[model samples]
Target: MVHITRGLATALLGFAEEAEPESFSTGLGTTPAREFEVDLGCPPETPIFTHFYHPDAGGSVSAVFGMDFSTPAGRTHGRFVSHPQGRLAVAITDDLHATMLVAVPPWGIDELAAFDRRGARQPLEIVEAEPPLETL
Candidate 1:
């Protein structure tokens, strides 16, 4: 199972809160010590969203979030999603389609909700007292 430290969770939520009124996307990764790291390459004022089209595309895309993972800031990497309504940010791994670790505004890290790749709610297991490699 993928484990997230409480400190990482709090920092992510805090970033989302601070970016309020605008949805944001950033990179997520882990350090050599197994602690999580949030990428800081994207400046706060960067345009948070964009539009593109492909020949294979068939449907419209809305509320799309994207991040650049080309930076060499961390070891194992992923991306961060922050929606406007304090929506859950879904983390995707090679082994799973998506996993959600979410905290609504005014809620603490203890109140995060976990969801499986299939969108089914799952139990959230947090590693206590573990500090993240970096903070927002």
Candidate 2:
């Protein structure tokens, strides 16, 4: 099971709100204890933004970010694998029609792989949990 920290959720929501009408991507990180951390990979004042769109999904815009896990800096944490490229992704439709938050690897990779190889199956469990206030 994978859990999303409230702080991380809040940050994602804020990013979705701020990047509305456009798509964005960035790197994500975690502490030694596995707490989620948003790795902008750049100074906060100047963020490196990338655009992505899904015409098949009703023109939904997405924010995809995180270290490639294959890079030296991404390997510093040693919590994830290099293959499949673990990263955080969020998508929201124009006009606030729909929104989604996607966590790669330990979060959703298994299910996706299964679907790709075998056909279809239940997805991994993702729980929304409140972290200690201090961690906020």
Candidate 3:
């Protein structure tokens, strides 16, 4: 379960799951999940970057499932499971298929560099944080 803040979105190429607004309620005391397509904007069979931006904002916790789905339809399906208190959960069932599941937070770049799978030990590059905009 990775917890992150919106500020760290770009660097990690991921999204921080947050609570859904009440407006999304299903009227049956249950909230329906928002469907997500893991489309990186390239051909589905194309190799995705080990670390790249997700086209859509992710749920509180996005699961990284392996590529073991029995059918083509199953492989393409993705959803954000809602949780109480504005949290979300993503289950990673298969490692081979779901290689990366990253969440953004106020994390130090050095901290994430240590987790990089690449053994190159490349120097870490930090992007300066932008100042919050003043309210009109």
Candidate 4:
């Protein structure tokens, strides 16, 4: 998923640097994610650094499912989802077909569109906060 999203970001933003080749690891041990930091290399088509000038500015997009269907029409559920980690994510289900997160904040959305050189506005829907993870 990270790879695909990374590609999307690059395709849309026109990255100069190649995505840092790294293996995916969801292990439960000491290993941490490196995909999140794929933009700061050399040539400049840095994925992470370029696409996300302020990824943390917005917040994380989270949910139990990928489909972020809104209760109201013409309104994005993202506005309500409490963006944690200062970033957003297009959360998906196990199959990876569905897409809901597309989680991006105001700045990131703007930055991406600008980078595209399309002079387009960023696309973002309201996201409500995700329910608590741990149960009492």
Q: Which candidate tops lDDT? A: 1
Model number with the top TM-score? 1
Model 2 bad stretches (over 4 Å)? 34-72, 75-136
Look at candidate 1 and give me any clashing residue pairs: none
Per residue, candidate 1 scores C-alpha lDDT tens digits across 8-72 of 66677676677676544444443322222343233333221111111113223322433322444
Question: After aligning candidate 1 to the native by TM-score, how far in Å is the CA of 99 from where it should be?
Answer: 2.3
Cα shift from native, residue 109, model 3 (Å): 3.1
lDDT for model 4 comes to 0.23
Better of 2 and 4 by TM-score: 2
Candidate 4, 113: how far from true, in Å? 10
Cα RMSD for candidates in order = 12.2, 14.9, 14.9, 17.6
lDDT at 92, model 4? 28
Please list the C-alpha lDDT of all candidates, in the order they appear: 0.45, 0.28, 0.25, 0.23
TM-score of each predicted structure versus truth: 0.48, 0.31, 0.21, 0.15
- Comparing 2 with 4 on lDDT, the higher-scoring candidate is 2
**Count of clashing pairs, candidate 4:** 25
- lDDT rank order: 1, 2, 3, 4
